[model samples]
Target: MSTSAPASLTGRTVLVANPSADLYGSDRMMLEAVRGLLKQNSRVIATCSRTGPLVDRLQELGVTVHITEVPVIRKSMLSPRGMLNLARIVMSTFPRMRRLIGAARADIVIANTLTLPFWTLAARSCRRPIIVYVHEAESSLSRAARTLLTAPLGLADGVVFNSETSRIACKAQALERRGKVRVVLNGVQGPATSRPPRDHIEGPARLLFVGRLSPRKGPDLIIDAAALLRSMGIAVTVDLVGDVFPGYEWYEDQLRARVRELHLEGVVRFRGFQSPVWEAIDGADMMIVPSRGDESFGNVVIESLLSARPVIVADHTGLREAASGFESAVRVAPDDPKAVADAVRRVLEDWGHFRAVAMVEAVVAQARLGTDRFHEGFGRAVEELDR
Candidate 1:
């Protein structure tokens, strides 16, 4: 701890480093935190993202912006080509960040994910302690980056995980002997309170799967679940709202063929890469998170609850803790269509009781699910670290 901290963080700047502009869940959370902090009179300067929905939103919020490219070359560093490209990105990004950090002269530096620990290390020269926020657990990394994340993650003055599941998983990987971690649930801020109530049409429930359209998202299991329901003569339709992960386009195509082979022409809809998926949630009745990977937290869970709906999340090592007491949520075996179909039957058969439970949960969650709540939670964590 230092004897001096930046005063109040009002006019004092805070630099947030974003690794990529993928328009994913954690990216959105990072943008919201910046916007909320600004409302309290903080100035935010984001680095290495010139494009994405977040950069546009930050400009609209009146924050100072420095845009540059931190190209993520998704390949092995050991490759003859990969090393050359990575070295270029690192060299290019280093100068841009040094310029951004110098111009911003930030009160604090915020690492939006483990991807930007280099930014945290850069902040050391400026004497700004870093706040590390983890939204997803570790991945099987290139040999070098994994070693780098451990030490910086341990020394970060503040660490915030989006869910208890994520916090525990992150601790299990990198923080068990390190320090305290905070759980800051992702928030939803919008004007839905005055809207018309959802009408779950009696024909077939419209289910949505809203993560990457890869095998990791377990779309295969959801399709199998649909097949199981068809076997029982129950009606259900699903719309998948994600794009295939890079290099997995063939797998996505294979799943489509499986749907066709099963004669599920009208049962499954692949709605690809929907922007502002909150609208899709508005139209649908239930959301499913079938990820087989370690999911740190999910924003779709909050969106479904905001729409006064519920979810069926897969239970597995990287993701199971989400089934804890949300009444509206049920956890079944990951990648098991039998368990998935059973959970769906439970929801459809008891929709009324489930809605009542979710309605009350919605009222209680209003405060926690807003942008302000996340800002307050994160701000408190940083201030505590300063003291």
Candidate 2:
């Protein structure tokens, strides 16, 4: 049976969060949720870091977006560097949040992350119910990160996880008192109609790897796999699609260094972060998800599938579940370049079979698991918090 809220929240007000707002997938999901909430007649006042790809998208959609800065302190905000960041979060965040919530008299607070101490603190003072949306896997995190993050878990009246893996991880990380955790998978919607075709894939077989340049994403392994493909005389081209996150230069350097060492420079290209990743994928023969740690749920994975792009993914937590139809996505060993190389060849060669199964999965996504379904489920989750 589906869960619905016992109480109504049609006239209630909510303070939705976008903690980092780094023009990434996280902010995009938050914006989509907020728009749905607005459609249901709930007043949503956004409190975020004040910049992202979603900002313009939201404005273009004609939503009322009020930005109250919620600084995202990646390192411990209580450390000397963290304390300075904490001070900034407090100084800029607290006052604006206090004024906004004070003026709006919000009934609910939907926090996008555990990082924003000021927003939830103000929500607590106002006696408003706070629903925490945990997009990350706290259990997969280093010990130090969990220590800094537990505060938000304790503060939340309820919790929403981005995927089932994230929900289990959240439960293991901390206890929820007022409400239980719910798994709300990220929504994947293709363009209203297809865009004009491009000829980028006319040469070699194009492959795409979307996300940051780091160990967790396992990009070096991907480069190694491409080099292996070159050795095997496969006409393949790999495009990596993200920049290094704050202070992760050493990890980025490692990937660049590997590309040089392996001589996969021409075969594998770092495309930086593309705004609409579909453009990159459309021109691709395949996609690779080389995650070292388990992904909570890769939006890119679903997005790739929706684009009818077959994938070769590491055997990680979320990918295992998402790659249900082995036809569309095949499993590879995490951090094993040779294994990845072997799997990619299989997926591309058996393209006709995988493409058929992948399209069926895409039908499920575009039909059953559309944004409206996300709205009905997540809006009900928020309404439950109101009760």
Clashes of each: 2, 1
How well does candidate 2 score on lDDT at residue 266? 82
lDDT of each: 0.70, 0.72
- RMSD of every candidate to native, in Å, equals 4.2, 3.5
TM-score of candidate 2 to 2 decimals? 0.87
State TM-scores per candidate: 0.85, 0.87
lDDT of each residue in 117-155, candidate 2, tens digit only = 566677887788877877766576666566566555676
C-alpha positional error of residue 115 in candidate 1 after TM-score superposition, expressed in Å: 1.1
Output the lDDT of residue 256, model 2: 82
Tens-place lDDT digits, model 1, residues 1-387: 232323576576778878666667877788877865665466778765556566676677776556666654342443556656666667766766666677777778887876665676667756777787777665544445444444567667777777776665454344444445667777766444523235455888878888788776788888988999989888889888888866899988988999998888888998888767777776677778877766766676666666677788887643455445578878777767898888888988888777777777666656657666777766665555544
